[model samples]
Target: MNPAREENPTLLDGFRDGYSVHLDKFDGPLDLLLHLIRKNEVDICDIPIADITRQYLDYIKLMKVLNLDVAGDFLLMASTLLHIKSRMLLPPDDEEESEEEEGDPRAELVRRLLEYQQYKEAGMVIGARALLGREVFTRACPDPALSAARTEEGPLEVSLFELVDAFRALLARIPKESFHDVAPGDSLNIADCINEILSLLQDRDTLQFDELIKDELTSERVIVTFLALLELCRLKLIRIFQNGEYGAIWFIPAVAPEQAGSAGEAVQSPV
Candidate 1:
C-alpha cells in the first residue's frame, strides 16, 4: 500500500494508516479487550460495555488498517459486546429475576474476563523474559552506552500498544488548520526514513522519539516517521523505553544474540 499522505487517510485513535500487512504475531481480541479495560481503569466485573465496545471496534479498524488478519474470534467478540450492550440497554424485567446475578447482562462476560485474567497472570513470565519476544532482532553482545544510559535515565520498557497511544497523543497536539498537503514531488520513502532514524540512533544510548520529526509536524511526516519506527522495532534494531507510564519515550539501540532465549540472555523488553 502507498503511504497515508492523501487528504482522506484512514484514521483510528487519531493515527492514519495505509499499510496492508498481516500482523498474525499480535495478541487476540480478548487480550485487546482486556487492554482497553485496564487502560480505562474500570471494574472488570461491571464493565462499561458501551464505551468498551466503541474502543474495541476502534482497535478492530486499526487492525484492518494495518492489514492484519482479523481472526474470527475478534469478530465474534465484537458481536458479543454489542449483544451485551443492547441487552444492558433494555429495561430490567419487572420480576425479581432482575435482582439475580444470572439476570445481569454483563455477568457472563465478566466471568470470562476474570477467568482469562487468571490464565494470563498465571502464564506471565517474570522480569525481562516477559519483555522480550522472538520476533524482535537481537545482537550478540551488550553495549556500554545502553548500560550507561540506563544508569542515568532508569527508564522502563514499554509495550507496542503504549507506543501507539503515545503516537496518537503526538498527532493530537497538531492543529488541523496547520495541515500541509503532500506534493508528489516530495513523496515519503520508508527506507529513507529508516536510515534517518538509524543516523539519529548512532552514538547515542537513547533517542527521544519526538526528536525524529521535531522539525516537521505535518501528518504525513509524523505518519512516515512512526511507520519507520515500527519497522525498526519489527527488525529488532532498536527498542523503546519510557521514563514512566505516560512519560518521555526513548529509543535505544539493541541486539539479541543467536543464543538469546530468555531474560538471562537478553536485555531488551518484549512488546
Candidate 2:
C-alpha cells in the first residue's frame, strides 16, 4: 500500500450512516457534496437524499471540530439538503401521490451540482489554454509613429491597478444630494475628452483640476473627463499628482520612447 494511503486508510471509505470520513479536503459545501457523490460511485442523475443529508451533517460536525470558518452559504446548503431529506422521509399523501413521478427528491440538487461541475471544469480548461498561450508568443513590431510621438515627451511612473483605484475613488466622491440629468448626445465622448486633456498638457506641461473643468459642462461630462484622465494614466501616457489633503490634481503628459522598450523587457524577464 502507498504510505500516504496507509496513513489515512479511512479516507477512501464510502458513506456510512449518510456520512463519509474524507471530506476535509473540500473548500466549500458544494465541494463536499461533489466528493460525497464521487465516493459513493453513485450516479449524479439519481441521488439518495437521506444518505447524503446524514453525510453532509457529519461533515458539518467535523468542520466545527476543526474550527473551520464555515460560511453562511454552506450552512444554507446543509439546511436545504436536510429539508429535502425530511420531505423524502415523510409518507406520501394518498391524494397527491402519482405513480408517473419518478426518481429521488434530491434530483434537482444533483442536476445543479452536475451543471456547476461542468462550468468549473470549463473554467479550468480555459485557464490552462491561457497559460499555454502566454508561454509561446511573439513581440509586437514597433510602430515608428508611436515612437516618434513618445520622443517629444518624458516618461511618468504609474501602475494600471493604481489608476483603476483612483478612478473608483473619484466615483465614490460623487454627491448623492441632487440627481444630475443628461440627455442623449449631452455627455461628452471619453476619447474627445482624452484628446482635450492631452492638448492642454502638451501646451502648458501641466493642467490644474479647476482649469481642466473651467469649460461650461454638466456633471456627466465632468465624470466622463475624469474617467478619460484615468484611462490615459492607465496607459502610462499621462501622470497625475495631488499635493496635500483636499488638494486639486495636476495632469501632465508622459511620452518616452525608451521607457516603453524597458517596460517590454521587464515583462519578458522572469521574476
Candidate 3:
C-alpha cells in the first residue's frame, strides 16, 4: 500500500488533500477504470494488476463513504479483477505444458477496456458535433415561406423525438402491395415530401386541414408529410395555427424574407 493512499483513505479523498480531482463524472465501471488507468499513466495493454486493484478498491470504498448507489455490474467487475489477480499469484498448473499455453488472465479485460475507450471517444466526438450544430448560424438565402411575426421569433427548433414521430407516421401511410411480381413504381419518399410541402407552402401561403390531407395518400405518406412540415417549421419556413381550445390545424408559410430565421410554431389538434 502506498503510504500516501493509506493516509488519504478514500480514492478521491487523496485528491482533496492536495492532488487535483480532474474527472467529475464517469459513465460506468469501464469509464471509471479507464480514468484510473489514465491518471496513473499505466499502459492499458499490460495493466499492473496489484496497483490497479488497490486503486479500484479505494474508489469503491469512496463510493461507500459518499453513500453512492453501488450497482451490481460494478461489483461484478471488481470481483472479476480480484479473481484475475488471485489467479496471477498461483503457480502454473502442472498439467499446463508451457506459459504460452496458459493465456494471460487480464487479456480479455484489457481488450474490452480498449474497445470501450474507443467507443467512448467516438461518442464524445459525436456529442461535440451535435453541440456545434445547435449554435445558430445566419443563412445567405432568405426563406419566403415564413410569416413576418414568426420570423421575428428566432429560428425554429425541433427535438429528435418529434422527427421520429413524423417518420413513424410516414411509414404507416405506405400502401401494402401483395403482388409478388409487381413492385410499386412510385411511392412518396421523405425528401420528396419535404420538398413537396415547401413548394405547397410557397404557392398557397396557407393550407387548411382539408387541403393538406389527400384521400389517395397512404398513412405513411401523411406522417412523412407532417414530419416534413415540422421540419420546415423548424427552419422558420412555416407557421401553424388553431382557433380556440380545439380547432382545425392550419399551416401558413412565412412570407417575410427575414422571417426565415424565426422560431418554429406548431398547432396541435385537440384530443
Using TM-score as the measure, the top candidate is 2
Full-model lDDT for every candidate: 0.71, 0.62, 0.63
Candidates 1 and 3 compared by TM-score, better number = 3
> What TM-score does candidate 2 reach?
0.47
Q: 146, model 1: CA deviation in Å?
A: 22
- lDDT of each residue in 147-197, candidate 1, tens digit only: 433544457688899899989988998778767654557577776777676
2 versus 3: better lDDT goes to: 3
TM-score sort, best first: 2, 3, 1
**Per-residue lDDT for 24-89 in model 2, tens only?**
567567777888888887777777776776677766665675577778878999999987878688
lDDT of 3 by residue, 167-233 (tens): 4654555566522334355575555665555556656656754455565455544665766676666
Which runs of model 3 end up more than 4 angstroms from their true locations?
1-23, 94-102, 130-133, 136-271
Candidate 2's C-alpha runs over 4 A off are: 1-27, 94-104, 130-271
Ranking by lDDT: 1, 3, 2
* Candidate 1 backbone collisions, by pair: 131-269, 131-270, 132-270, 137-236, 138-255, 138-256, 139-255, 139-256
TM-score of 3: 0.46
The lDDT of model 2 is 0.62
User: Which is the leading candidate under lDDT?
Assistant: 1
